[model samples]
Target: MIVARELPVHPQASFFGAGPYPARRAAIAAAAVLAGFVLTAIWSAPFVDSVIGDSVANGLLGYDAKATPIGGVLAGTLFAFVSGLAGSFTACNIAAFGAVAPLVGGQAGEKRRFATTLKPLGWIAAGMLTVSVVYGVIVALVGTRMPQFSTAQTTRLSPRSVQSMIAFGVVGLVFLLLGLIALGLLRGPGFLRRHPAAPLVLMGALIGGFLIGRPYPLFRIMFRSAAEQHNVLYGAAAFALQSVGNIVVMAVLFLILTHATGGRVQRWLAAKPARIATVTGAALLVGGTFTLLYWDVRVLGRLGIIWFPMISW
Candidate 1:
């Protein structure tokens, strides 16, 4: 018989010491997912021409190989981050439930109720991730289509369009007001203790309202000019700028919602909101900066602002 000697555990290796390991693991997983997304976006460029050849030839959309190579890349990166974060949050919640389920079930009915509430959140996150990925793939495959632009596009503002914009603006203001009200409700004494989920529910409602009310008619107006100019770089830059704007507006609204709901939202909301904000902000800032740098160079080219070396990277 062979004798086996067990290794002694380190004295410092307590449960508290091990607590941050899961967080570190989650961060690493998120980073890896982000990297994979970027790589996949780069790989999808070759198929763009073949996938949308008919649309391009039919004058429905425009495509330039050299100028817009980065469009798919940017879209892919955004979609990947969104989907990855959603997945990470869902996984973290599921893990939390697994650990707490036994204790909660043994004691008061808190565990069951908590798990029941969490299930829908997880499902919604999953669904959103799926939709984001599908949209990303479609965008990548078809490339972005240029909207038809005419003189009507430039100068014509219809009465119905004006009325619609006014209506949307009014609706958005109402939601904004409601969000503020919810915030006030949250700040009352014992509000956090009594109604933990109220802030999240209110925030979601506000964000949904904003998305529904916002108009992106600019894309339609600029489509023809962008395509006729064969300015893939300009198109990509504009798309990136628009996406950044959307993300910025969403982030500001998110922050406002959280602030209104009290200083801190729920654990689940708190965890991913910071990460999403950080990633989205970083991407937008970097993309916008680069786009502006290039735009300045082009303007200099056109206006004779400065004569310098035409450095192509």
Candidate 2:
């Protein structure tokens, strides 16, 4: 029988702190989640895509991708990819930045900057591709769409509101559980803890799944076009690229961090198991709480279930 060796402790500092203290870690996690909830209730934190998304759309595409005339196969595909890139920082997908914490840290005995940066990203891409392609293909086959495109209300809640809640709720739960496990508050499957790649893949899946509930104007345009086309290959390819575009910025940042430092910073931080836990835990908690609170609390407030400050005003 082989016994697993303990990770070596590194002496350093990071935004998440390199020290190991359960009490402090728990407090930080709680605070981060609380902030997520508050910001979400107020305005879904990062849903303000118009500012950035529109700017990108106009700057590059020469017109607002929102409800603009998208022509030609090439135009449709480019619009899909660009629109996705535009919303990369929206509340719908912002939480994905957390995966950077784990990816920044090199795997045990893996120190090459190139491998360290690309390997986990590859795994994440695989996960994202799986979800996005399947979703797109399903859209092609069923010709169905989210109720967000409609202006109808169902009693206390609009169908679009309910749809948003359901889609984001599921993904939020996944993030919550992952955060708990990372914080050691919950004991998940042994393999999840044993294999670092597992959580990263899961992260990517959740990020890709963001599209399922996205109500952004630009994305809605893309969705409408893709659905109408009824082309399986186009839908799959389009969604796959969209998913890639979603993470392109973060992935680039990760690459720069790893390559710039030649993996030294990553090594120093990832060297300590405790620091890795801290960063990963904080990220998951914030993302989970934000997704759930933004979609549910905000929507429910609009439905009169609960009072939200922003909604009241």
Candidate 3:
């Protein structure tokens, strides 16, 4: 007698599942981002800056931090680290939180708590440092200063304003497009959808790019110091530390969530594809809208081209 046996079949996972879930996610994400844009417009357009940008930097490093001469390599490293820690709260930098959900995985029956928790953070660091190191090297080799430091102004735009416009505008569009893809409204990169770590890497790359057009006083100071050192390695290290500092708080929060919940949060999210889409899509939408409206549209108001509410922090 011959017997035939059938092998087990497994279902493929969707980046963002099909069905009513996509529509629900899109609606929820759009509404949330819209509300955020409204609040930032009426309140703080460059929300992080208005909220804690220069003040945080100045308070932590002192007003003279920019002008003070570096005493040693260690001092400069410390400055870069502290400055990054200070900038963590900025609207621009805060967008890095979008990566948190993507980084955490809900592996079925996973028992290694320490590895599970720290692995995501390490992946994030790898992605972040990859971009930061490259950017630092390129910037160092080319030898340029932060445009934000320039006082020269055109009829309506300054160097700083233009930098903000270009940097945030590009990054915002990318985030917006990513959110759309995550919501299933658009196609995502094949790799990004298939690989677990791809989204985290992309998110980290965006965070590293923050150095391209940042205007924070302490950051500007750090950049100048890095330039003066004229060592590409130093620049790379400083920028690396900066990225590290930017996410320290968020990392702590993620750890707390994982430990406090005993890893239930990610497991719950992983059980359903739509749940991940909801969290990630919402974050990307908010980050994208805030970046665009704050840096570009808000600049128009500063130039007196339109009326945007002005507030004193």
Best by TM-score: 2
- For model 2 the TM-score comes to 0.85
Name the regions of candidate 2 deviating beyond 4 angstroms.
1-23, 41-47, 107-110, 144-150, 191-196, 262-264, 267-272, 311-313
lDDT of 3 at 139: 58
Off by over 4 Å in 3: 1-23, 42-67, 104-112, 144-149, 267-273, 309-313
Candidate 2, residues 215-284: lDDT per residue as tens digits?
Answer: 8778887777778788888888778878888898889888877678665766666555566677767777
> Which portions of model 1 show Cα errors greater than 4 Å?
1-70, 73-171, 179-199, 208-313
> Tens-digit lDDT track for model 1 on 32-52?
334423432232212332333
Sort by lDDT, top down from the best:
2, 3, 1
Poorest lDDT segment (10 consecutive residues) of candidate 3: 6-15
Instruction: Report the error of model 1 at residue 110, Å.
Output: 19
How close to the true structure is residue 112 of candidate 3, measured as C-alpha lDDT? 46
- Per-model C-alpha lDDT, please? 0.29, 0.73, 0.68
- Write the number of the candidate with greater TM-score, choosing between 2 and 3: 2
Give lDDT tens digits, candidate 3, residues 190-267: 766477666666777788877777777677778877777778988898889988989998888777666767768756
- RMSD, each candidate, Å? 18.0, 4.9, 4.9
